[model samples]
Target chain A: MPDGFDQFVTDRLDRLLRYATAMTCDRYLAQDIVQEALLRAQRRWGRIGAMDAPYLYVQRMVTNEYLSWWRRRASRDVASPATTIAALTPPVGDPAVHHAERDAMRARIAQLPRKQRAALVLRYYEDRSDAEIAEVLKCTAGTVRSHISRALKTLRADNRVMEVL
Target chain B: MTNDEMLIREAIGEEAGQAVDPGTVLAALHGGRKPRRSRGLAVAIAGVAVTAGIAGVMIPLTASRGDEAGPAAANAATGAQGEQTILVLGLDKLVDEGQRPDSIMLLRAGADGSFRALSVPRDSRIDPESKLNMAYLKAGGGDKGAQATAAEVEKLTGVRAQHYVTVAMTDFPELSTAVGGVEVCLKKAVNDQLSGANLPAGKQTVSGEQALAFLRQRRGLPNGDLDRIARHQAFLRGLAARLATLEPAKLTALVDTVKRTVHTDAALDVLGLARRLTSQSGLTAATIPTDGSVDTPSAGQALAVDPVKVRKFTTEFFGNGPAPAGGGAPNGTDTRTPCVN
Candidate 1:
């Protein structure tokens, strides 16, 4: 209803959705996550505006909300090894081959534990500092570094991801 | 930390470039419904009968009638001068048999531009055998609760609470919807029968009633009130992020919403000051370090408020220094008040 809210939604919606997608590894669920995060922010605009980095705050919310959802659902077996690599392959290739490689990288990143994935996402995707990641995760900077270290190790071990990178 | 890591970070940043529209997200958060309590609701709720009952229950006590007319002086003296400390209190456990504070948080913005929130347990016992919820109730309810709670908090912590803001339960849904929705992480499925918040675990966006249910559901929580406080803090953090990305119109609508629902002694001019103080500051939220619970002789089992420990917490948070300019004398300020219906 306000003037800039619509524009704000339009401008940042895609990026937030991508963040959700990367976090959940599911486009539909990612869309839902972004939407919910935005709505919550809208309702508390007054108090939110009073904060320092409102975007980071919302991103943390989305991640935390996503984790809460994960906690509720029964854990499924990790996607089969065969399916995992296939899922990471980009659908559209040709001139956008680079985009496909990036997509595959994102898929690999999503397979990490929620916290690890979040650490990687914030560190690389959002380009946040270790301290910033710690703030969002409510952990110490050491914890964030450990998450990154472990996440990197996992990514390195995944031969397919290594090649893509 | 390495070049490879930096490359990965660039890729991730590129991926984040493709954010989704928040409008749809906002709709989903509100469960795809428009705000129910519009201007009409405010008008209807303001009628004589409602006012009479609220007034009767929430009359302020004239304990120390000092300078009530010097809010301007208080602002001028307190603004960005020296070592400033804000006291943030969250009223998570203040449930009165059936009623709850929804969520109450206090933030002490220091002069160094760092802010910390001191979460006051709702169940924590105060003087006169009242729980933490009464502080807000005594402050005339709604936004007044923050004011009353802040006043009492200053007494307990020996910190000057210069500004206060209070938001109601209904604001949760509207805000969630407006920002699209909020994403929260749960360790496992939460089917809170008490609050009626049923959800599968993992990352998910919740709508109107669901958001309220999530914040209000303490019985099903592992640590009960403690977990609830964590959730409230997480939600506040998420809400702050969503607010940063709003467009002009949505920002205006949000401001209008604040004008309607949020009650603060902070004037329009103080808005900029508050914003500056909070922005770029490390906002730390900590529960009032106490021994959790205390057994009272008259009041069976209650959450204990350790004045000595709380005093220490105040000192650490606000920096044990000279009181802010215009701050009244440190002694005789009573922060404990009972909220009895």
Candidate 2:
């Protein structure tokens, strides 16, 4: 009974954390949201564990947790030692200019609406197909495409503004 | 596809790569208990002991289990063998208004030294026209306010609070600085004039004025006051952890801050409770489950909390069951402090 759930956590916990971290842009929040989602999944493991792609359904939970976190107040609030954008600072050896560009781009992505940001992260960060992204976002594939396009359009416009500056 | 997309991918990769392993989470999962977070968070979970210690007053008792032996235990019972529940409040210092409790928590300290804390959001609906925070104001603030809030908590949770404790929000700065500083992280950089917060995105130690700003900034947060509450919880966790290991001289200063800022009922033994909590682990902190937000006629917008659910949750939490299932470790167990938005 418990083996499936434990195995699932062992197999997918890190990946889920990574997906959550990418989506939320906050590793601590990602860990928390992922843990919350997984705990909920574990509670109903009898049902969720039987599904074909439990990981996919669990991913949906993580996505919804990220979107609804601001809407529904998160319950457990603990202080993590390394928080915020500082964790996003690229590995030490990148060129100074490259680091600045990456930081600037990350800030721009953070500014996108949560859904659009999720779409971009799904496509670019996770390399997920539109159908897979749709399943997680609970939107149709067409909406997924539109989300990515609209996000890109905004990024392009912001990029031009930065260039002009 | 585009240069911008490539940049976005690279940025997301760098951030995602920072995701840490779920070692602590797994440990708790296997233990069938809440993760034992840092000594600081244990202090937050053990709300009364640490806060009262910092406030330099009686550590307010928690849990309605006082129904069984709480009242007697709170007042004269010297043997700390049974579970005790205490209502703890943090009062916000308003300029024109007297004061209102921004944080309301029911903390239960078990005989074994384990603790459970349940935080009721300030905006939780007490009635159709009023919120939980208003209970304090309606009761004319101060000790009376603590009584009113305690009564409301009792009514909501179906348990009686044997003892109550109150802390001033203004004292947070001094209390925070007294322990050197409380470290906090923000997901995004913020510059809010309303709360006097001007900080860059990253992990940094905050003290004095900055600490107050970090706790008070709600205007620009994504979840408004709820987010602010999270900040306060995290800060308390960090502060409590520090208080747990404070040196004798620094502890003396903290006690002075606590004395001026904290108010409790006459019965509680502050130092005794502090000693029990500081040396223990197994603390779990949770917020009352809320069903989104609603626009109230009297209050602008309030958290639509179901009293039934709240009571049920508390019953199960404070009840005799072996902790709630899937109890993730309370926060701050990780060596790294989590960054918040």
Candidate 3:
């Protein structure tokens, strides 16, 4: 690719990393997803990078890679040696603290089904509209709404969140 | 967004600022690009085509011992991404007579959608005197027939099949009718009771029962199974040529017909074949070339197959290496050189 493309990736790397990390919860998995998307983006840099929303297009590829998990299941099955589940697990501190409820809720969000978790993350974290999320997830906007509705309902049912509501 | 949504989003983004090495991601994509391709293609003969088409030349002669037409069921197969070698069979069931594996053809479909078809005559001896078709009968019926036929093909050609699709003979009529019928020509009229074929001389469009009869009859024709193989080649060429001219809707129906009538072993189904099809290079049908005739005391009359000839043909038409300098191999459609004696 052109030198400008390298500079572009260098500049946007942290943002893409943030999106991947938030979607996957695991740091290693997020890096892998971002890497696959970038490699694909590099191949189409001239066309895609020129588009108004190149970052969104690559983010969609990352989402697709996660959904089409069967293709890379064999190699990725191994847990990353460095990023222990305990280290990345939410609710890292002791239970009797002020942040207890918030941590517990984050854990529940992580436990949600993949699509629902993706929908919820794209909506609340990245501030994507339902139509934007649908484009990324390759589904109807109605389906995306249903996913968010279900995820939020599950979260709301949690006694701690119920108290807050 | 609700309060819970805001809180949840805030908690999820706690560790989003961590920097990951860009080198790591790019390396994974480059390092693991290949080695995922699974070799071998499963093949089965779709026995019939009832849907008529615009035009087709070879009428596959098949006899079914059955009460009514039934769906054969296409299945899936596993193959490499770039090119796949599939075994396409034409199967028939005679009432109380058992299943007859009438035609065997190996189709090599490239990543580019270029395909080359090689037909193996039923009379081609698997052993010194035994015919290739007997493999199905020897193994009994159902999946055993598919296995036995696949084994014979592997032994004959160097290609090892990992998947297959077997289709019923009756399904051809529906396919034939859908294409406005396949056109078949003959120099003289023919009458064959065994195959239920009675046709006049000259060119005619055949469909339904008539199409099946036209494809199934090779008894009176002195060449026997060899003539039938030619008819099979002609049938494929006719189908390919006709499909090239058909409306997309007609082609889709034909694909559906193949999907319904054929049974495959792996996930590589007819729809998969249809979707990947592009830049159709050319279609050539050829038989496993034999050097001379041989009559073995144990196996009766079998073609004296030249192994050297088979190797040359495969290398020319199917090898991954550069295509041979000259035109690959002699085609079955070329009536100039008699493919079968």
Candidate 4:
């Protein structure tokens, strides 16, 4: 491994893990994703380290891994139960009712089409612009806009989401 | 525009901004790399050599992992909050090796939880008769280009850009690949010999290298640079949507990619702000409407932008709503006034 490979791993490992978690919506799966990506990155550490942005190479690896998983499953759903809950549930669960409400919201968001849901999360949660979101989602700005519009319409129409909000 | 939209943005922002330990990630990476030298190798004949080899590699991995985690972890935990503006500058004319800004876009997020995106064309002939990209190069490069470009955009759009994210041509590939690939829609089959990018009309996901080609293709495009800009916008929107689905590992990879390829004044907190914005719902996108024309200036012939239409578009996009006033819904409180049940 090159001298900076270890440092690169150390420096970026956490963010990569978080990103993987978000993408997979499964913590364990996220771990596996990161591990695999890191392993691949390590294997090509010398060549990668010489590149302008080796992390980009690792990122590509991780996303490709996730996409492969999606292709294998033939289902586009990426969110897990925990992720759905996490997205909806507030941190402090003092009241069971609130928890339930959060869960409902999560379920509603989960019910959205995969691409639409992804667009909502990226545009709103990640605060990425249409361009950035488009880059990440592998689509055009017009498509991104359509997704957002459709996602928002669905979210707004969801009785549960409307009630919760 | 609506209450639901605001609440959704607040909720998503809060959730996405939550902190996690970068140390664990570093440790995992190091642990994965640890050499597995069998203790009883060759019936103990190679024990000493194997043990030495393992220790030599393990020690540094552990040491480096240890030092790298703390600061990054701290940074992640202390992300930014509230309304902010981020400038994303695209250097259009410059190729991979060149360093400068060719185009600029301003993104503003208000406390009311609304967003506005504005773009300035690269070829817009300005006072000095130089293309918009020259402003960045003349101001220095990289961070300097961002600052200079931001200042110029403020003059053009009448909105102050708070911070900027500058990406080189190479950064685009790294970035596009980092989040997987971006999907682009082609209206017609594109075979641009100059940029070496060929594609049939339709929807397709492109990798980093391909993305670079897509963004660079100019000739054969109906609107020329204008069409390219639209294509760039489409690519970005797709990329953002793709990123939204990223698992933690991929998100971390994105952060790493940003650290490597992007130059920005945005603090870790601001990136956090970006994360929150992405996690939210109801974000709207619109282009700064413009009618392109040719103009002759002291510098030479250049693309002329209709300043009046640009100004009107800017005001219309960003001026409708009141400036966002505060951070997301009060922490730990789901203030959504339930509408359904």
Per-candidate alpha-carbon RMSD to the true structure: 22.7, 22.1, 24.4, 22.1
Local distance difference test scores for all models = 0.51, 0.64, 0.56, 0.52
Off by over 4 Å in 3: A1-165, B1-80, B94-97, B187-204, B252-257, B269-272, B279-281, B291-301, B319-341
lDDT of 3 by residue, B1-341 (tens): 66776777776676354435656554554564411110000111223221111111111101000001112111112222566666665665421135666667677766655666666666676777587778877776455666788788877777765555554443455667887766666667878887777778776666666766666666787666666665665555566555555554444444333422344553443334433443243456666675445777775777655555665766666753433432223343334222222
* Residue-by-residue lDDT tens digits, candidate 4, A99-128: 444444554565566567667766666567
Candidate 2 wrongly placed segments (more than 4 Å) = A1-165, B1-79, B94-97, B281-283, B316-336
On DockQ, the candidate that comes out on top is 2
Candidate 1 residue lDDT tens string, B50-167: 1111111111000000111222224323445443333222222211122234333445545665544556666667775766656766654434555566666666666666654433
Clashes of 2: 24
Least accurate 10 contiguous residues by lDDT in model 3 chain B: B59-68
Ordered list by lDDT, greatest first: 2, 3, 4, 1
- Give the 10-residue window scoring lowest on summed lDDT in candidate 1 chain B: B56-65
TM-score of chain B of each: 0.59, 0.70, 0.63, 0.63
> Candidate 4 chain A, which ten residues in sequence have the lowest lDDT sum?
A72-81
**Candidate 1 overall lDDT versus native:** 0.51
**Candidate 3 on A1-165: residue-level lDDT in tens?**
546557667777777777777776655557656776777777888998788887788889888877664221211111111111111222334763336555556556655777888898788778999999998889999999999999888987864543542
DockQ for each numbered candidate: 0.09, 0.12, 0.10, 0.06
